[model samples]
Target: MNDMRIVERDVDTNEVKIAARDVQVFYGDNHAIKDVSVDIDDKTVTAFIGPSGCGKSTFLRCINRMNDTIDVCRVKGDIRIDSEDIYDPKVDPVQLRAKVGMVFQKPNPFPKSIYDNVAYGPRIHGLARSKADLDDIVEKSLRRGAIWDEVKDRLHAPGTGLSGGQQQRLCIARAVATEPEVLLMDEPCSALDPIATAQVEELIDELRKNYSVVIVTHSMQQAARVSQKTAFFHLGHLVEYGETGTIFTNPVDPRTESYITGRIG
Candidate 1:
């Protein structure tokens, strides 16, 4: 990612990086996400945990406006980053996506060389004007993804040729290549083995130092281990959100407690 550009800006850690109010998501006739409001701080990891169909992923997609790709999906609410209205007609979705990169549940790397895969975003976004610039961006991204040492030997190797864990890390490196300020992940380690999951979890922690990271995971334990703030959603409603310690040990909502205790999903 073009993290160099971010250094010039005044990144206030105390200020809210993302703020959503009365957010609602509807898929055709079904309301997938009900009115939800939450503030996500900069340089922090926020986890969204819930059962399947609980709308956690749906809401995570809302942060990056990824739902716009679905014709039947409609998002209505105020979602702002740096106090700028993302829903404003003047805002370009393409540019918005570049600033808010996303990692999907599966590792969907481009069927291109490892170098090309990481360079793709920087090229498309015009973040690099020269070959040297692109090369630097690719290396920095891979380092940030924490996989450079493993794959730097063969930059031209097919990205699909790597192991499952490597592929996921490459995908993450690809996301970071765009120099996004915020990273949204949807069950990033679901398909990974335990060892691979641990690697991604470690990378997620490292990422929060530079970009605000928001993750949606079904694994409560993983969320507890990685996130500073936790938001629990149930049946499209935000059940509880607070400090990870409090949400796990002393929840203000019974639904949250039930889900945490295994009595309910």
Candidate 2:
């Protein structure tokens, strides 16, 4: 195993928090991912952009071992988080998820109070010692998610009672409450209005100050606005990966250019 260290860009700047090498996935007879590889940096946002069925989301699931739930799914290759292989048999998915939480495309809040939504992770992971600790975690997480002040007075309200944007924020709070080192989001803004989308985007920007964030998005403009690095996937292969500015302005691969220019999917 290679000693995975951050690929530094300058004297004081380090890039890449997670390194994936020769990663591939197969669902029975169908190969869902090819030999895809890339580096994700700490405290930065990396956006995966491509057409539908390009395996962006599939690859994202591999980071936190979400694909393990599927009985037919088979994954091969090495994915290291801070130089530790996350796929080792001894590595528990539950614990891995605690370190690398995820927010799905849909706003899926449990049938519980908004406070419980944020407190759920700490409770399950035993992160809090007492009621006061749990309460503190819930409040802090909600605030970090940018919805605490709005719901501070009514913590007991059902999470589903909130609007789509608010529910999504609640999901984000739940994820952050786990104190995850990496946060994975799959099309977080796909279901919100323009205003709500902007709000979530801003929250995502703020999130990058503390955790490495990987987002799979179909919106090229969104990727350009929120991500420092961008990786383009096409038909299960990572076509190109580089600085977001370079990828958008001058992509190295023809497939990437074609997709960006509306020439092909």
Candidate 3:
């Protein structure tokens, strides 16, 4: 697959990013995520992989408080962005989301034109002061998402009219338009073809130059292809986490080895 493997950051890089400590999640009476802790280095892509219902997605949602949308879901433990506690009561979820953007498995675009889709975040967050500024933001985000050339000719076309892959790229542009420091993606390529998946994967690699990216996927190969680090979860617990190359080639946990070898999910 892709050869852009992850490398450990320099201690003096001056770009430390998100850190999670004893993070846990619960859905009403059922605990979904066990105590988990990990660091997401700046300008890196960290992939989460595990069996279904193993809390990979749940933990991802916790990063940006997406679980708040579920009435019964509750997140516990500490999540910090650059040493600031994101779970603080004074933290505004809306503003936090702008700082830590997310792209879901399904492409949920606004019922608006492609241009508007990319411009929506900047508009709502007051990041652009004028039409020209908004246009610039939209163009930059689309380019960063690697879909600008393809859709540049039809900026006014409805976002829903694009192909599935294109729609997802539009969604990515929308998320990055706000200039988020972190990008969380949940199975972003689950709906795209191989060619489209490769395009998106390449975009993910490029995005790490500006923001820390976290992804949850079922495909072990995809995790190996796109992430510098890989985290494996089992039965709501983080079973193993380390460099992607090391995890795939020499997993320290038996559960991880079993899962990677196709002996268990």
Candidate 4:
């Protein structure tokens, strides 16, 4: 790994939304991530693609401080969102999470009514002044999640009762209800059928218009389809980062080329 050449290119012309520098993660002395650095652009979809256990998801968790929940996980380095250090002692992880919403690999919706699931964040954050405002937020968020039409009539129904794809979309709506600036998805489509995955991919494209979308995906095809920027990780190192097309077609690093060509994973 030490002899591997790493190539990083800043191809996105959009405004930078998140900047990570010299980031490292350790789980009880097990170094899960190395010195990874990258600039994520606002209103753009950036995909993290690598083999299993390549630290893509771990690094994703660091953006929202989700790793802090684990007893042995430790993160070191500077991660800034809109120029604000997310790891600063003064920053509240709960509040920081509101700004950086995450959707996990599975469609894990709270065991509550659909309306309540989407309303949970807004209520806790005091984002709504009244029932009417909360209702508006829920509707807008569901619409953004592209599941409003399917669930509008059954808002009082249980969220978990929905199909896997609908449940995922509902979870996305719940994440968006708080008006998060960045949306983090950890292999969101891995559990869905091809059609549902396409729907979610389309929704991701729509979402990039408003939020900085960072997705950790094992599927290179999905990464190529949905993201404008792509980062290739291998053995805890970011081997290459650039425009998605460039990373796929003309990677500067041999490791990235090998991974892209199915010679290595």
Candidate 5:
């Protein structure tokens, strides 16, 4: 356990960025997620790890109401952000999404120029006031996404024309442009090469300083490398949730230990 990337306590969770209590998700007859509750802290990186179809992604989406898009998906129980009930009727899903950004498994950039793609969110959310202001936002977001140097000269180039990894980074820039308080990445590195994956992983760690970052990744080593806290899911239940080092080295649940040890996943 001493060799663990980290085996220490330095995080403060009293400030919850997202809270889910007794949460459940149903896609028609299939229960995708079971009763689960966890307080995701502000300015922290939390990883969700589990076997395929185990419901990590489903639960991640719940934090941002991504599940609302599907006609058949239904969520039960309480979910809140900043101590405000997110599921309340007064909370618009569109506005809520702006507060909680998401990056997907694949890089799905808008089919416009790179500048326009990064500018899309701020434009819609009315975050930019003038042309110069918008330009600053675009540059700042690209810098935060760590792709400014690579795409700076190609501002007018189509976003889809970039390499797969670059496109993913562009998508990330687009997400952060809106100044979301919480960022959710669902297998964001699944489609990238190792180098690209490493770049994105580094960005994820940096982003935790500005946004609560929640990631769902299959790689146990990736979780240990990037996250301060980790949640292990199995068969639609959160088997264990704790510090990344402790979870990887001494998981309280046998299922989590099995998944991390390569016995089952």
Candidate 6:
């Protein structure tokens, strides 16, 4: 039975990176997310798993206030990153997003060159003082994204010219160029082939060494492979959250068990 549990790795610290308390999201009259509370640890990968329209992705967007972009969407309750209230009126959403970077389902790189694609964030955030500094940032971010080797020779090439996997990696580089504390991914590999999915999964593991990673994935296998913690959502509610192994092997909630065993989704 012990062999059935997934091995949990040690992280840099036990400190909570992002904390959400009784969060609720409403799109017009529809309550999209309901009362989700969780403490996501620093330097760890946390995966949100649930059926479509279960609010897992909705909750992920709440961490970085991405939902704010939708005019009809309204978020309620406290969400803090490193103990700072991100919802405070004084906090700038743009600046907040820089601190908490996000990668969407599809690879949407800028129409500019690969170098410019990765450099855009740092340039906009004023992270570099000189051209040399900007160049270094671009190189480092691409290396961190795990695609520097493939595209190093074509730094000036159009970003959209890359293969699907490479473009996704470029987008990741763009996200990290701002040196965000948290990385939010919404089904980042759904558009990729198996080889690309494997590469991104490997990158996700490496990324947890520096930033807290929160991913919304429909694949339970991907969650078990990449995350230390797993969260299950159902019909706008967070049903269970705990160590990934425990959630998969010995879930306390019947709903989670049903979902895990394919009885319900």
Over the full model, what C-alpha lDDT does candidate 6 score relative to the true structure?
Answer: 0.93
Off by over 4 Å in 1: 1-13
How many backbone collisions does model 5 have? 0
Who is ahead in lDDT, 3 or 6?
Answer: 6
What are the TM-scores, per candidate, against the unseen true structure? 0.95, 0.95, 0.95, 0.95, 0.97, 0.97
> Candidate 3 residues 1-265, lDDT tens each?
3342344422224365889999989999999998999888888899999999999999999999989899999889999999999999999999999999999899988899999999989988999988998989999999998999999999999999999999998899999999999999999999999998999999998998888999999888899888888899999999998788888887899999899888987
Q: Per-residue lDDT tens digits of candidate 1, residues 1-265?
A: 1221122223234568999999999999999999999999999899999889999999998888899999999999999999999999999998999999999999999999999999999999899989998999999999999999999999999999999999999999999999999999999999999999999999999998899999999998888878888899999999898777778877899999899888998
Off by over 4 Å in 2: 1-12
Least lDDT summed over 10 consecutive residues: which range in candidate 2?
Answer: 1-10
Local accuracy by lDDT, each model: 0.91, 0.90, 0.90, 0.93, 0.92, 0.93
lDDT value for model 3: 0.90
For model 1, the local distance difference test gives 0.91
Cα lDDT for residue 152, model 1? 96
Candidate 2 residue-wise lDDT, 1-265, digit = tens: 0111223222114666899999999989889999998988898889999999999999999999999999999999999999999999999988999999999999999999998889889999899999999999998899899999889999999999999999999999999999999999999999998888898999999998889999999888888778878899999999999877778777889999899877887
Report the lDDT tens digits of candidate 4 across residue range 1-265.
2112223343447889999999999999899999999999999999999989999999999999999999999999999999999999999999999999999999999999999999999999999999899899999999999999999999999999999999999999999999999999999999999999999999999998889999999888898888889999999998999888788877899999999889987
lDDT rank, highest first?
6, 4, 5, 1, 2, 3
Weakest 10 consecutive residues of candidate 5 by summed lDDT: 1-10
Q: What does the lDDT read for residue 9 in candidate 4?
A: 41
By lDDT, the better pick of 1 and 2 is 1
**Tens-place lDDT digits, model 6, residues 1-265:** 3422655545455799999999999999999999999999999999999999999999999888899899999999999999999999999999999999999999999999999999999989999999999999999999999999999999999999999999999999999999999999999999999999999999999999899999999888888888889899999999999888889998999999999888997
